[model samples]
Target: MGRIGNIINRKGKQDAKRASVFTKHARAITVAAKEGGADPEYNAALKTTIDKAKADNMPNDNIKRAIDKGAGAGGGEDYFSNTYEGYGPGGVAVIVETLTDNKNRTAGNIRYYFDKNGGNLGTTGCVGFMFDRKGQILIAAENVSEEQLMDDALEAGADDIITEEDGFEVVTAPEDFNAVRDALVEKGYEFVSADIKLIPQTTTVLDNEGQVKAMEKLIDLLEDDDDVQNVYHNWEITE
Candidate 1:
């Protein structure tokens, strides 16, 4: 009975985390739709964002509402689009992806976080070259053969496929993200997450104690900032 209770509690916590992540992702989709166009057909980026939202279990109503807001018909304000570059502890380059309506406010808030957290915000090109824009997809590895998965991804134009500890990671070029994802879905693959993110070209290895503290502080700051849509770094997190 004790073990069963613990299992239930763990599942509940996992569900909550998933829900929160989906909410954040939904905000990103809304912002992307507003920046580009409501029609996914005409806007490839919007389509890619929407596909990710769907994969995340974002409700259809929520998706429609976000699109309406993006179209400026649902009383949703416009969001600004910007990228922030910075360096964390141990000179780890960080890229913060943001969608904000007010650049000054966002910048001030971001700067404050960095200042307080022992990092410094940098100019536009300071750390961007250290990362590459890549389309990443996460799918459950359950009941799926590695060979089969690789074959499908290769046929669908994936750049690389790897089996991570938690699941399978599918990588694609920025342009082919949507088509490759759709191909996998048509073939009945269960996706965990799919989106374009700044992938670090090389990783910075951190020592034992510094890793946890830096990661905790970074996550707290990033999650609190409404302007920060996604945060990426090349800090190699190890057990």
Candidate 2:
């Protein structure tokens, strides 16, 4: 490929990434508003989703349109959430959470991705039991003292803190997420990301190159789907 080809590939990837982010965020805002009503003050889920969208630098106009759509003023598209469980390469348990207006189409795409990527989509609760739901937050490891972080996180009701070379990950009970986050904010700590996540109980390490590649492709396919909100797997592999 020539230089022009590389440029086109990069642009295409960028466009796809942007479109994926926009679709996911818009659908999140719409669904959150619909479920809890359009008023953020009265709807904690909507408020949090909207804040996440804004954090990703989503346009206010787009957010407003989604709110209107959810309020039945525009778009008229109805969306619902779905989850798919499966085993990926190396028998790694995988979970895909989706927001879709067309369940049939979303199901088909998810099945196809799993099948083509050397995996099989399975029934609900198949892989779900191997995970635990927790509120997780991450902060960059730099410019912060470990002692201070440990003190603040523990005082803020975090259940545990895992320090890595790249970042500090704080885990909290689901019900304590907001309280913990607010306490950290008061201590002037900024988060890289904060979310309720399904943490795996165990992990499969894939040393085979083929298995690693297949797992990576499988994740990319699931995440690239317009309806997918999140994808989780217990594969400890590097690309």
Candidate 3:
């Protein structure tokens, strides 16, 4: 499996809890809409969130309601974006992105999770330099030709393309993501997953079983949080 495939498999496990997954997606959408305007055309963040929600198969009604809530058409609690960087067992870099109305509660919970799982939350930018922000779009390899995909993706301003056993990962510069995705869509390509992500520059492997277990638990705990939208890590997990 490729990096995108690995992500898909991990998400597949998380998707088993359908309600929780939808709730997280909804929260992200609302936060994006709240920070930017409700109109996606004028709000790149909102557009990206909406696209991610759609890719996850979130219902249109739920998406609309979340947008309305954030846009103030339906008054709701305000949420703020918070990013927490940390190191897990084996010194693996981890970045948690969240949207929460209560910073104290979220921060406390996040810190507790890390502390309890053999990790420690670090100051901002501590582990940030270890990763690069990029746009990733995943397309299944079932019937698609790798050469054609590379040709189209490169033409659409994509930065690179990775061929995996199960799919194709089209990478793009953050600024060119929206245009590249849109161009692909116009050309009738469908996505398995598409989002701006923090891609790790290097990966850490835990040879000790205890540290591996701790790292896995740490990721699970972070991902299960209602306020946490994303948990990026540099741990090289094997199947």
Candidate 4:
């Protein structure tokens, strides 16, 4: 996504980008299966993970192998989730989510990135209160009217609909995520992206090029790490 303003564009090679996406999805599927059991029917989380993977066109064989690894059929390595909170240049708050097998290694690497980029890693929940966790679904705006999308989304239990530059966003409560998503799917709405995110309540604006450059470098470093699952920040860049 190359979104101007609040949304940071993810720019990279198409092939490498796709491979990274698939790897992350596979890891998520494996973890969900390992923790919740291999049967998606009995495991709501696993089912949702699979649905997300399928939406991205993840190969069936790869999905099956990940599930197998989680069930010990393919000898999967153990992994655990970790989160880090910190402040970047211009007092911009950021939260980094990670899935890792080695806590020390990941922590060291994360701290280094923050320190090297004129930032500091803070204790857990340092900036969490500044954001709201919500289920987000993004769909293309093409061939659809705003009124129509809003009506359908609200009726499906979505809390709100935000009209983005190139798409429509449906925000739902965590518990109502699956219900709203499935309902929209039934109505034949295809999504560009669907997942839970920590939306910032207030954003920090960077006026100077130096601050913007530092923020970008911090984000790029964090995202390049394989253990880092997602990075949320409060810096709002203007065009």
| Candidate rank order under lDDT | 3, 4, 2, 1
Question: In the order shown, what is each candidate's alpha-carbon RMSD?
Answer: 5.0, 5.6, 1.5, 2.4
Q: Pick the candidate with the highest lDDT.
A: 3
lDDT of each: 0.76, 0.84, 0.89, 0.84
Provide the global lDDT of candidate 1 against the true structure. 0.76
lDDT of 3 at 159: 94
- In the range 180-213, model 2's lDDT, one tens digit per residue, is 8778878898776677889898888899888888
Off by over 4 Å in 2: 1-16
Candidate 4, 56-118: lDDT as tens digits: 678999999999988889985788899999999989999999988888999999999999888
lDDT of 2: 0.84
TM-score of each: 0.84, 0.89, 0.94, 0.90
Give the CA lDDT, 0 to 100, for residue 72 in model 4: 85
What's the residue-level lDDT of 238 in candidate 4?
Answer: 65
